[model samples]
Target chain A: MSEYTPFEMIAYTGSRVLKDERIVFVGTGLPIIAAMHAQLTHAPNLYMIYEAGSLAPILEMGMPLSVGDTRAARKACYLKGLCGAFELTQRGCADYAFIGGAQVDMYGNICSTIEGHNYDKPGIRFPGSGGAGAMAANCEKTIAIMALEKRRFVKKLDFVTSIGFGDGAPDYREKAGVLGSGPYRVITNQALFGFDEATKRMMLLEVKPGRTPAEIQELVDFELIIPPDVKEMAEPTDEDLRLLRDVIDAEGYFLKRVIKK
Target chain B: MINTVSSNIKNISTLEYKEKKFEYWGPTPDESRKLMVNKSHALKDKRMSLKEAVGKHIRDGINLGIGGFVNTRVPVAIIHEIIRHGARDLTLSFQSNSICPELLAGAMILDPDRVSIKRVELAWWGYEIIGIAPMVRYLATNGIIEMDDYTNYGMSVRFKAASMGIPFIPVRDHGGSDMELVNRGKMIECPFTGKNVYLLPACHPDVGIVHTTAADMYGNARIFGAYCTCPEIAMAANATIMTTEKVIPTESIRSYPNLTEIPFPVVDTVTEVQYGAHPGASYGYYWFDMDHIKMFRSICEDFRKTGNKDALKKYYDEYIFGCENHDDFLEKIGYKTLKKLKDMDGGQPIILT
Candidate 1:
C-alpha cells in the first residue's frame, strides 16, 4: 500500500486486534472507526456497545461523531442508557474494552483525568474517564490506544483513571472488587504491547517494520520487557486503507488528523 | 462496619489529595423522600415557560443534574434559560455531557456572581470528537471549581440509586483506581459474599433539567435516542424542569404506556419547545449543527486561551440574554439552518401519534 498517516495505522492495528463474534465496548473516534473497519473486513460479528446505551447498532447513517450521537443509537438490538450498557459489561457480556488515555504506567494503569500531582489542580487536565474506567474494570479484557511518547508512558501516573494490574500484583483486580481480568493490549503506531502474565508488566510484543526495540524503548519513560522474538507490526492493506478513508471516515473526522506533540 | 478489602493501590499514582468525609452532594435520601411525600401528585397541566420553571426551582447552592450524553438530546434550550436566569454556587451532576456544562461554565466566566459553578460530580466533561472542553481545562487546572470524578456507570448508578429511593448502590467498578480514593464512594466488604464491593452514594439533585423527544402536557416523556440518564435524573431530583420537542396527546401516550420512559409524577414542569436540543441533536427531528457548536466552542476556547471576555460577552448578549425565549433564539438561528439540520436527520422513525 501507499504511505499512510499515523492515525490510519492505529485504526488498522486496532481493527486487526479484534476477534470475531465478541462484543467490544468502544470509546469515541478511532475505536469506533477501528471496530467498523473490522466488521467490514474480518470480524463481521463483532458487535459494538456505545457507552451512551446502544448495543449492536447498524452504522448505516454514518460515522457517529460522538459515542452518544444519534447515529450510534440507530437500529440497535438493545438501547437503554449508560447504566444499562455498563451494567451489561459488569455482567460479563462485553469481551473487549477499546479505550484511550493520556498517560500510562508499566502496569497499564491509565491516567485520563489530569497530568499533575495535585488532584485539586493539575498541570494539564484532559477529559475525565467517560466509560474507560468502568470498561477497563468490567470488560473481560482492555485494549488501549496511546501516542507513544516518553511523557505519556510514565513511571507513575498522575491519576489512575482506569484500573489495570495494580502494582503488578496478581490479586489486585480481585481485591479491587472489579470483574475483568485486566489490561490485555496497548496499541501504538510504533509498537504493540501486551502484559507479561507472570509479572503483569507491559511487554513489547511487536514493533513497526524498520523500527527496532531500542528505538521504541527510547520513546518510553519506563523499562520494557523487550523479548528477542519481537515480530514486525503488520501494515494495512490497500483495501483496509480504502475502507478506512473512502467508506468509514470519509468526512475526515478521525482518520485525517495530526498528532499533537 | 465491615472490614475494607484493599486493592493495595495506595501510593501507586503520583497523586496528593486530602481525605474527604462521606457526605451527600445534594439532599439526603430522607429529605428527598420527605419532599416527594409532601408534593401534589395530581396529573395537572404542568406546562409553563422555561423562565418560570428555571426561576422557580433554580437557586444558589443547589445540585443540578443535567441530562443527555455529550451532545445528543442535550438540554441546550434549558441550559440557555438557566444561564439567562442565573444560578450561583451550583453543583452539577451528570454521567457524561458536553454543551450543557460548557454553556454554564461560559456564563460563569462572563459573570461569576450571575452564574457560578461550585463543583461538579461527573464521569466526563469534554466535547467528544469536537475537542476537549476548554472551560473545564481552564477552570479545573486553575482550581476555579472543585471536581469529583467517577466512571460513567458510577454516576448513572448513583442517580439510579436515588431514583429507587435508596441511599447507596453497589457497583462493579471504580475500585482499584484513584476514583476509589477521590470520589465519595466507599469500598466495603460485602456481607453476603465476603468480597469487596464499591458502594456509591445516591445523587438527588435539587432540580434536574432535561430535553426529551416527545411528551404530553402532564410531562410523561419518551426519549427516542440514547436515554442517557435522563429518566433517572428526573426521578432522582426533588423537582424536574423538562422541555420536549413536541407535546403529543396524552391519549397517544396512554395507548402505549410502555413508551413513556419518564412518568408524569416525577416531572414538576413541562415546556413544549421544538428543536429544544438544537446545536445538539434530537432524534427523528434534527441532527447537530456542528458549525454552530464549533462556533460557540471556539468562542469559549478563545476566551480561555486569550483571557479576554469580549467575544464571550458578545455571545451571551446576542444568543442568550438578548432572546427572551427559545423561539426567539431559534429565530436568530433562522429557518435555513433548522431545515438543513432536519434534512440531516433523514427521518429516523419516532412515534408522536
Candidate 2:
C-alpha cells in the first residue's frame, strides 16, 4: 500500500516472519520494529513481551530507544519482570521468540557475546550477553533478524552466546536440550531461511525483491540450501515504511545509518 | 591645642583633621572569612555516616528517593557506604527514564534485599541482561518489589513534586485506554479533575547525599556541571550531606559565585571525598572505569551462579574493602588488567541473539 525503501522492505521481511495469534518475545531495535509491523498487519493477535517487562499490543513507530521506551509502556498489557518472558516461554504460554543478530551462523547459533579470540582482547566490543543464552535454549520458535551485512554473518562466531544453529543437525538441538526447537528462522537483507525441523539445518526459503539467489549466495561465506520454490520478497507495506521512518527520528549523522540516499 | 578644653570641646568632636586608626574584632584582611577555604573532618558525625544516614532517613514504609540518573552521575560513594552498613527494605524511587550503573551496585553487589516499589520505570537503559532490566525481573518474580511505571514526562513531573515537598502532582501522562490496566491496577490513580490527571505521590528522602566538585569550609557545594535534581532533593530533605571532590577557600569560591549550586546555609556536613562517584566516574574527569565494572560484573556473575552472598562479600573484601579509598580500588583494578580483558576474547560483541 505504500512506497517501500530497501530498508523498510527488509523490515517487512522481518515482520512477515511472525504468524497471526502468536506470543512474541521482542528484542530491541529491528526486532521491535518487526513485531510492531506484525501487530499492525494481519497478526493483530500477535502479542509482544519486551525485555523491560512490557507485553505490548500496539507499538509506536521507530526503533524503541530502549526497552523502557514510552511506546512499550503505552502499548503494554502488563509490565512484568524481565525473566518473566523466559518463564512464560518456558511454560509454553508463548509461541515465537523474535530477536536481532549481531552475528549469525548457518546453524542458527548466534554470537551476541565477544567479538574476537581473547576474553580481554577484542576487535569490536558490545555489552555482554543479555537473556539470549536462556531464550535461545528455551523459546518455542526463534527468529533472528540482522540488518548488517556479511562481516556480521561470520563463518564461525567468537562465542556461541545464543544457540541458533549449534553443533550440527540433531546433535545441536540435542546438545542444547532445547525444550522447544531452538531458532527456526533467520532473516537477512539477502535471503530468508529456516532450519529444517528434522535436521535442524538451515534451508533458504526466499530472496529479496530485486536480488537473485546467486547474487545473495556469493555475499555469505556459508553454504545455503536454496529451495526450488524460492521467490522474490515482497515490498514493505505503507504502514511498515511509515512506522520505520517515524521510529528513526534522526537529525543528521544517526539518521543516515538506516535511511536511503 | 586639642586638650585646651573649652566650649569648643563639642566642636572638636567634628571630623578629625589627622588620620585616625579604627580597629575591629573580626579577622584581618590577610585572614579573610575562611569560608572559601576547603576543609574536612574524618567521617565522624553519628547521623552523618553514610550507613546511619540512610538508616535514619529511610524507613520501611516510605518511598526512598535516590539522586542520580543511570550510571553517569550516580552517587556511588554514598551508595557504598549504605551497602557497607547494610540498610535494607527500601522502595527506591527515581526520576529518570532509565537507570545507570550505580543502582546495579546496590541491587546486585551490596544489598541482597529486594527493592519494593510500585514501578520499575526508566526512559532508556532497560534492555541489558546484567543491568536493571534483569535485576528488576529477578526481584519481581520473587515478589521483591512491585512495578509501578510512568513515562519520561510522568517521572519528571512526579519528581518535581517530591523535590518541591508536595504530597502529589497531577499530570497529563498515561492518557489512553491502553493505560487503563495500570490505572485500574492502582499504580496510576486518576482523580476526577474533569480533565485527564494522574496523581503521582511525593517522594522525600530522610537524608539526601550528593557529591560536588568543590565545597567551602561551611559545606556550600558546587557541582562542576551536569546538575540532575540532586540540589532540588537536597532542599526538600530534612538534612543534606555532601561529599566534595575537594574543599576550597570560601573566598576563592566567592570570586566565582555563579558556579555555586548549594549555598552553605542549606548544607549540614561536608567531607572532602575524592572519587566519590566510584563505579560512576565524573563527567569530564574520566570515562567509566569499564575494566573495574567488568570485574564487578564478573564477581556478580559468579555470585549469580552460586547464589551465595559470601562469595560476593569475599570479592568485595578482596577488591573493595581492601582499598583504602576509591583510588585504592581503582589501583587494584589496574589498567594492565583492563588491557588483558580484550585479549581474553575477540572482544565484547553486541550480537542480537
Give the number of the best model, judged by DockQ: 1
Cα error of candidate 1 at position A33, Å: 0.9
Which residue pairs overlap in candidate 1's backbone?
Answer: none
Q: What lDDT, from 0 to 1, does candidate 2 have?
A: 0.51
Provide the DockQ value for model 2.
Answer: 0.02
Model 1 ranges with Cα > 4 A deviation: none
TM-score of chain A of 2: 0.85
lDDT of 1 by residue, B28-141 (tens): 999999999999999999999999999899999999999988888899999999998889999999988888999999999989999999999999999888898999999999
Q: Candidate 2 docking category?
A: incorrect
DockQ per candidate, 2 decimals: 0.88, 0.02
How big is the RMSD of model 1? 0.9
User: Please, what are the lDDT tens digits per residue for candidate 1 over residues A1-261?
Assistant: 689888998999999999999999999989999999999989999999999999999999999988988988899999999999998999999999999999999999999999899989888878899999999999999999999999899999999999999888788898899999999999999999999999999999999999999999999999999998999999988888899999999999898877776
Worst 10 residues of 2 chain B by lDDT: B4-13
